[model samples]
Target: MKPLVVLVGATASGKTGLSVELAQRLDGEVINGDSMQLYRGMDIGTAKITADETQGVPHHLFDILEVTEEASVVQYQALARQTIAAIRERGKTPILVGGSGLYLRAATDVIEFPPTDPGLRAQIEAELESEGTAVLREQLREADPESAAVIKDARRLVRALEVVRLTGRTFTSFLPQRNHLPSLEPVLQLGMKIERSLLHERIADRVHQMHSTGLLEEVRRLDAAGLRKGRTASAAIGYQQFLRVIDGVLTEEQAVEETIIATRKFARRQETWFRADARITWLDTACEQLIDQALEAVRG
Candidate 1:
């Protein structure tokens, strides 16, 4: 069993700052669990940490890939496991921190996801590219209405359909067996939470700051790299909105407003997802004794 500390929360909930503080106190290294933070040159829109902000603490999995390359959850899990093992072998704690629930869940679940069918996957992807998402979505809506509701994106929907078409089982039926790393050294999982109003305000401010700091320019660079707006990475909340703005589908001001709204919706989904997790130990952001309480948890 590995001794791990996980910090999970929604965007703009102050995960990075608190994780850094906790790592300094605990003598730990941070392994990023955020998806957007993995891509190189996608700094401002993703609110990626600067070298100055890290303040000499080593971080993993930031700026590792180009926007043209796709890093899947399976790949992330493998890298995270290797990183965690190295950290533990050196007798330091491994602090896993970020807002990506899927990535975090993939790392911690300790389950082998159903093996993907490469040929079928390629065919499905081709259909997605040629037929467009709406048409493929309609196809899924007919075959697997339940899955269609959840996998709304064309790429995801097509993949789900592929699994079902090949195996004759609902994509949900092939769920990997649920397993967890043995809990030792009291794996402290802290979730930062704040009021809706305050969180929304913070998200809006962060969006404005990204705009001021050249998020549009970053998106243009990704576009230049041949990654278009509708690609999986580009579908990310902030980046996609700006891509629309760049394409003349939206105004700059409209993009800002839509980005903020989309981010708020994502935060709500995150809150809902984590709320159901029995493992999480929630901490109110407004509590005056937050650090003390968190420290106490980690100590215990």
Candidate 2:
């Protein structure tokens, strides 16, 4: 089997451009692993690759969801695996690209997600609504410190607590192990490594560029299309800050500044998550001969 090629990195680390080049050279189809990029009309904030950027390569799993619909990792895993199999069967390399670590692992690794209980989930959600995320975060800290340490939002915290209550096991226990699943093909994981200071500067510039490119206009359009109704979409980095602008709580300048800060923090979290996986081959994205280096890594 042709090993699946995965390109992972923090936001603004230039994965899209390099992935397109690699796909062109390798005759590969790009499969998006970013969670937010799945939603349609989320182009600007998600930094989704444009048609021209794709360089005529076939891309899968992009713009697959409505803004109001929540994305599930379980569903994404099944879809991504199916896509990978079809691509391989067609004699095309499957290049998985994005910064979402869990989603990437879900697609390529032997991870089993826990079943959900609507009643229990509803109860936990109600508690979260009434008590706020702080209370549930503490509860999760006690039940599953590993999950709590990483999961920042109320929805995820509630889910983790629900899993703990329903299965009597820590949420982290259901995470992907170091070993690969026998049923799936092996993956060559490549991660983009950038200097922290340069990455921060890139993130700041990207945020400014997003604002300049009418990200607020995009947010306004999405909000009109029920963006706030979608839990996941509403909580996205740029969208949330812009939503605050819409709510009259923040000025546009404040929104822009806040978005930069939030993005920097998110990049840090992404780096921490991907760095924990020793299987990935880290490459310097800033190098002039990045494509050649990446190709050598794959071929070697």
Largest TM-score belongs to which candidate?
A: 2
Clash totals for all models, in order?
A: 0, 0
Error of 1 at 256 (Å): 0.9
Residue-level lDDT tens digits of model 2 in 16-57:
999999999999999999999999999999999999888799
Runs with alpha carbons beyond 4 Å of true place in candidate 2: 127-153, 177-183
1-300 in candidate 1: lDDT tens per residue? 445889998899988987788778878899999998998888888888899998788899898877877768888988987888898887778889988887887766655455678899889889888888888777777777777788855667877888777877777765543334444243668899789899999999999998888888888888888656326578778888988988999988899899999999999988887776778888888888777767777877
**lDDT measured at residue 87 in model 1 versus the true structure, 0 to 100:** 87
Q: What TM-score does candidate 1 get on C-alpha atoms?
A: 0.89
Off by over 4 Å in 1: 125-145, 175-186
